[model samples]
Target: MNQKQLVVRHRLRELMVAHDIPSVQELSRRTGIYYATLLNFYHNKFNTFNNRTIATLCEFFDCRIDELIYLDKKELCGA
Candidate 1:
């Protein structure tokens, strides 16, 4: 079976800039998410994350999933 490469483009940094959020630490506090987890998401270092986490982010930011994460197929395929 062939597996499709899926890349998650984290838009947290962009949102932070637009919203004037000081740091990931502040986001963590406001969202009740772990600082390290937020850092991982900010850096795109996490291989996998749970839906609950995503839900929390969406709720906190009042944004949809598309605004937070983008699925880049071209980058995944190296096109």
Candidate 2:
């Protein structure tokens, strides 16, 4: 069987460093996204995310969704 996993690249940290964002709180303030949500993204804990959030982040960062998340495929071998 084959399975696919959605892997988040989490480029916000790098973008923050490049843009001197300082902290997630600052990012939240700049993007109007909740600090807790940004914190979860920073920590790679993305159990709950939606199009609105993604759109907001993309608009704030001037980036596309592909820059934020991607999928990875894995194959399982059965005996």
Candidate 3:
């Protein structure tokens, strides 16, 4: 995955942790995402995820796409 993608994934997980969510199960309950699909996101096992998953994440996290996921070129240089 690209740096932006990796950063987004890491940030999302950090947000979840900050909220004291101990498991993906809690996120699934809040976001209505299946455990298996959530695993995909948690592990960054795929290069791309479905639009539905993205939308759900945005809604449940109370964040815009740009907040939860951004295409930050600066991340590439470790800036």
Candidate 4:
């Protein structure tokens, strides 16, 4: 049998480009999210999501959760 895993992905970069956002620092300043935190997410180096941060980003971007974060299903091999 094959196993599957759900990988989490974010569209911050894409959204930024589509919205004409120049840099992550500007986003953080406008959204009131910490620069470093947004930087981490911008680079996809985050291990977990912060609800408040997500909500703030959604509100700032006028977007929904599905538009921000999504899951990717992957199959894994067994030992």
Best by TM-score: 4
* Global lDDT scores for all candidate models: 0.84, 0.79, 0.73, 0.92
lDDT of 2: 0.79
lDDT of 2 by residue, 1-79 (tens): 5555545466888778877999999999998889988898889887767778889988877787877665555445551
Question: 33 in model 1: Cα distance from truth in Å?
Answer: 0.2
* RMSD, every candidate, angstroms: 3.6, 2.9, 5.2, 1.6
C-alpha TM-scores of all predictions: 0.81, 0.75, 0.67, 0.87
Q: Model 1 compared with the native: what TM-score?
A: 0.81
| lDDT, candidate 3, 1-79, per-residue tens | 3354243343578768767778898899888899888887788676776899888888877778776666533345453
lDDT of 1 by residue, 1-79 (tens): 4446766787898888877889999999888899999988888888887899999988878899999888875333333
> Candidate 3: where is the Cα deviation over 4 Å?
1-10, 72-79
Residue 74 displacement (Å), model 3: 10
Q: How many Å off is the CA of 24 in candidate 2?
A: 0.1
Clashing pairs in 3: none
User: Which regions in candidate 2 have their CA more than 4 angstroms from the true location?
Assistant: 1-6, 72-79
Model 4, 1-79: lDDT tens digits are 7788998999999899888889999998788899999999998899999999999989888999999999988889881
Error of 1 at 43 (Å): 0.8
| CA error at residue 18 for candidate 1, angstroms | 1.8
Cand. 3 TM to true fold: 0.67
Determine which window of 10 residues in candidate 3 has minimal summed lDDT: 1-10
